[model samples]
Target: MDETVQKSCWGVTAKAVIGLAGVILLAWLVIGSESAAMIAQR
Candidate 1:
């Protein structure tokens, strides 16, 4: 039972990471100029 719970938690975390990455990509595409300026500032 503990192992199954741990696996479920891990799966949720993985999905969250993937979703975040997708959102970041979409934002980068939409805000192309701002993203480029930020990168240049760094």
Candidate 2:
């Protein structure tokens, strides 16, 4: 039972890490595009 609980916790932690990484990647892409537009306008 203890091992099962540990496995579940690890799964949750892994999912959280992946989700956070995806968010950061999306933000970077958005910011990059915005900056690119500004540069082009200038």
Candidate 3:
């Protein structure tokens, strides 16, 4: 029973890491497009 609990905790941590990475990528993509457009205006 203890081993099962450990395994579940590890799985939850891995999922959180993946979710954070996805949010960072999305923010970069949105900001990058706007920055490019501003530069092009000059």
Candidate 4:
């Protein structure tokens, strides 16, 4: 029982980490594009 619970917890943590990473990557891309546009305008 304890081992199963530990595994479940790890699974949830891994999913959360992956989701957060995806969000960060998306935000970085958007911000990077805006920055590049601004630089190009100048």
* Residue-wise C-alpha lDDT for candidate 4, range 1-42, written one tens digit per residue: 999999999999999999999999999999999999999999
The RMSD of every model to the true structure, in order and in angstroms, is: 5.4, 0.5, 0.7, 0.5
Compared with the true structure, all predictions reach lDDT values of 0.96, 1.00, 0.98, 1.00
Q: What would the TM-scores of all predictions be?
A: 0.73, 0.95, 0.88, 0.93
Higher-scoring candidate on TM-score, 1 or 2: 2
What RMSD value applies to candidate 4? 0.5
lDDT of 2 by residue, 14-34 (tens): 999999999999999999999
Residue 33's C-alpha lDDT in candidate 1? 82
Q: Give the best candidate by TM-score.
A: 2
What ranges in model 3 sit over 4 Å off? none
What total of clashing residue pairs does each candidate reach?
Answer: 0, 0, 0, 0
Q: For model 3, what is the alpha-carbon lDDT of residue 11?
A: 99
Q: How accurate is candidate 3 locally (lDDT)?
A: 0.98
Which prediction has more favorable TM-score, 1 or 3? Answer: 3
Candidate 4 ranges with C-alpha deviation above 4 Å: none
